[model samples]
Target: MNSMPKYLLMALALISLIACKTSQVSTTPSPAAGMFKVAILYPNGDDKTFDMDYYEKKHMPMVAGHLGSNLKFYEIDKGTAGRTPADKVPFVAIGYFYISDVAEYNKAIAQNRDAIIGDIKNYTNIQPVINISEIRQVVGNNTK
Candidate 1:
């Protein structure tokens, strides 16, 4: 048997093993459910004064501390390349919060309502577009 074929077989086996290990790790939500996701989207192409660094570093941590294990934050940057007749090139930011339920989500917001509002004011330099969503199902991971 050629050495090349032997090396190829070894690599294939290693890849398969890694894939199996990853698949074995579950990503399903835990039975003791206390999680939700919040998504925040910002306007497009304005580029006026949106301090993402401050929001991620200072504001998010503060909010997370207030909420504790009940919440998780996910942020996404959505900036388009150019402008168009339909306002194509928009600089957008999305933040997702994972909390327990609607009531808890509301409570968390209310608790940090002032700080949240202030952070938004400071970061965006303009009113931020806000949206709250309920997570019906998570495709992967079941742990926490």
Candidate 2:
């Protein structure tokens, strides 16, 4: 009777340990879970007028007020070598915003699409190609 109780307690402890391990794995964010929407805007030419003014004055304020979200803009100076050669690289401007829900994102885009389009038309001489992308953060890198 004593041996039976000892074996049962050991079995229960093993089960509890396994459950805890599985729960930890399940709660962690997967590679796909970290995916976000990204937009890339390329300049028409060497024109600094549109890019500079739009970012500093018009676009930044409007995005902050309307979307209640901060925007991160990057100028693609150095290309990714074999992946994206310098010669092939367009004068690229990349914008990133956090979007957790697709439905909410689409709704916001719809609401502000026309205003953004108009602003681009008035400010930029070169039409920008907007590309939608799914972005995943690289592991073990300090993005902050």
Candidate 3:
């Protein structure tokens, strides 16, 4: 059997592509009205002890209970390495909290501040540097 001309075949293919369209999947990010807050605590001096096990098992649970609905999610990142593997981690550990509101976060924190502070001694000697940040989703071709 004889095939159509190359130009005609190409035109038909283009038309078929345009006609046979599929439903597009929504790639919208999850709805999160609240901001994300992170507090990174750096060790004050060389002589310090951080009890990771206790922090994960005890302290975080207490914080979560107090936080309640205000707390959307929480994470802990232990400083294991720096830019170079040989280099020491700048901070001892970092705490990330996705909160519904700043005021709620503060209130929860205020109510349990003493207990939280008290627990710190059980873990590490270093007083960490704290930082709060807003959560922003980067919407671009690179992001899904």
Candidate 4:
């Protein structure tokens, strides 16, 4: 049987996730109920090299290009260690992209699904854990 490409599958899943409880875009980590996107990438087995440069320079730009305005503030976290120093990190990196609404973000990804999925190869070989979730600002800025 013919199966959809992995990236396409990931895109479809992301779209579905957004549709169910979808959107908010912000620079802060505050969870705004129905508006946030979080994508995490894990290392594919023993592969040690994760091209951080390409991810920042090439892959993300391609994603932003297609996502356009729907793409709000986003963050990338490169894992250095787990809860302790000895334990290895579960995932290599994480991406958090916020948008105005779920439906709009879903539409944006659906339209540029191919390009977005295809660009994954430029970064890592592992399949990322993509999740659409609500952003809740548990703690406000303490500096103020």
The deviation in Å at residue 25 for candidate 4 is 20
Expressed as tens digits, the lDDT of each residue in 37-107 for candidate 1 is 66666765445667778777887777777776566544556465546666665545666666666676678
Which residue window of length 10 is worst by lDDT in model 2? Answer: 70-79
Clashing pairs in 3: none
Tens digits of per-residue lDDT for model 4, 35-109 = 666565655347655777888788776776766776776777887788899888877777777776778778888
Candidate ranking (TM-score, best to worst): 3, 4, 1, 2
Task: Tally clashing residue pairs in candidate 3.
Answer: 0
Task: Give candidate 2's error at residue 59 in angstroms.
Answer: 1.2
| TM-score-superior candidate, 2 or 4 | 4
**Model 4 worst lDDT window (10 residues):** 22-31
Pick the lDDT winner: 3
Tens digits of per-residue lDDT for model 3, 81-142: 77798877877787777776888888888999999889888878878677777767635467
TM-score of each candidate? 0.59, 0.50, 0.69, 0.68
RMSD of 3: 10.0
Residue 20 accuracy (lDDT) in model 1: 92
Query: What are the runs in model 2 whose C-alpha is more than 4 Å off?
Result: 1-35, 43-49, 69-89, 141-144
User: What C-alpha lDDT, on a 0 to 100 scale, does residue 68 get in candidate 3?
Assistant: 90
lDDT of each residue in 1-144, candidate 2, tens digit only: 789999999999999999998888444433344455545465534654355556546764564354544223222332223334545435444454544554665667678988866776555565656665566565666788
**Number of colliding residue pairs in each model:** 15, 0, 0, 8
